[model samples]
Target: LDQIILNLVSNARDAIEDNGRIDIKVSTGSSEDILEHNSIVKPNADKYCLLTVSDNGSGIDEEKLDKIFEPFFTTKSAGTGTGLGLATIYGIVKQNNGYIFCESKKGRGTTFYIYFPESDEKPSEKQLIGKETKPDEQVSSTDKKILLCEDDEGVRNVLSKMLGAAGFNIIEAADGEEGLRKFKENKDDIFCVVSDYVIPFKNGIELYEDITSMSPDMGFILVSGYSHDVDNIAELNENRNFSFLKKPLKPELLKRTIMDIAKHGND
Candidate 1:
């Protein structure tokens, strides 16, 4: 569920080259009103749950919309991006017994409507993301500083709030390049780095490689919404001063990871 949100938001961010608005709205309706021109959405849904992400970015051309969900079929420049974002979103929604539809015009921006069959079963709290309803019960905080690198503004805000409430000072970066710069500037003071695996300019691996070369004992945590990032880290063949977490972080889980790394730094 978190991966779905991250991919859609990231795609929207990439679409807008300049200032634009992205609106996320949720509504519910009967299957009849929402399902049209698609035979797949008819049988499985009685009522539908709609999560729409609308963006005022450079919209897709009619010719390209059909191929948008195809894996590795990106229109981005070479060495810039992957078509995997949309393809992953499509697969996740479908696996949850849902469907995704896109509406767009060349210059009018785009909206993606995701329909999920409303389910009565709520995931147990153990499976929930950002599980901080019991904040007082969370791991204690420290005075150390943490470097947070993520390109998405909304996600960065939420994470900052969570970590700040836990009593740590956060040094922020919008992308991998800025993150590396800050690391160099504050190398002597920072206790650890918590960064997204798929960041712009330079990826988490590059940042990790460069930083660990300079401060081999500095604690590092690499995160991403993509599972294959795990495979990438595995290729490194050594895991020291390093750990990883999948995206849509649970609050207590993140707090524990950070505390552990900070403790290691103290040692």
Candidate 2:
């Protein structure tokens, strides 16, 4: 819910150029109302919670509304946006068994409607337990290390926390060059390398090549916000030791990938 609200509000702010109004309203409605709004039948629920975010800004083009939820589809200038915000919102909505619809007019304005099944049950807090470690992942060595290379500090910290929670020792670096150097220093103990495609000094692919030259079977995962970035890395397909993940990564997916690599020896 926090992610959905933050992304929607952020996108609304970006759309406005001047003194524009952004409105957010939350209300309760029935399933019949939802079906009328999107014409899509959702799971039967007695009541639903509706969230509406509307903005009077440079609205999206009618044709582009359909593609707004797609990954890497952004109206912002290059380098200004990753185009993952809306896509992330869409995924989150769907994951919660919710529905989302967007209405926009080029010059008039834009509005987003999100619906989630209302639950009367009180929210329960549950501890998050890490997945069971596969037998193959339990190497004789005490250290289960992952070399994490990401330029963004926030993203780096988040990934670090996630890996750390999964019982992996994290060696962090801000860029490709630092990552490579760290990998070399810890080469004997490092189990996997997780890196972003674009970074200072050297790119992810170059880093992959340099490290693989010495350890051909080194487990590596490359992450990128742009799909084309992965497509351009021909070495990825040829190397069984390497895998690529598109940005806006989910924690479960990341952990699963690492476990798979560990269990299979990156083969």
For all predictions, the C-alpha RMSD in Å is: 4.8, 6.7
Score candidate 1 by lDDT: 0.79
lDDT per residue, candidate 2, 1-267, as tens digits?
756765676677777877988899999878887778767675568688999999998999878888999988998878867888898999889988888889899877899999889987865454245456667566432367899999877568878987788778999999998999999999988878999999999999899889999888899999887668765567576677688887666666788788777767643
Best by lDDT: 2
Query: What's the C-alpha lDDT at position 265 in model 2?
Result: 63
Please give each candidate's TM-score: 0.72, 0.63
- Predicted structure 2, TM vs. truth: 0.63
RMSD of 1: 4.8
Residue pairs clashing in model 2 are none
Position 21, candidate 2: lDDT: 87
**Candidate 2, residue 139: lDDT:** 41
* Total backbone collisions for each predicted model: 0, 0
Compute the lDDT of residue 194 as modeled in candidate 1: 87
* lDDT for model 2: 0.82
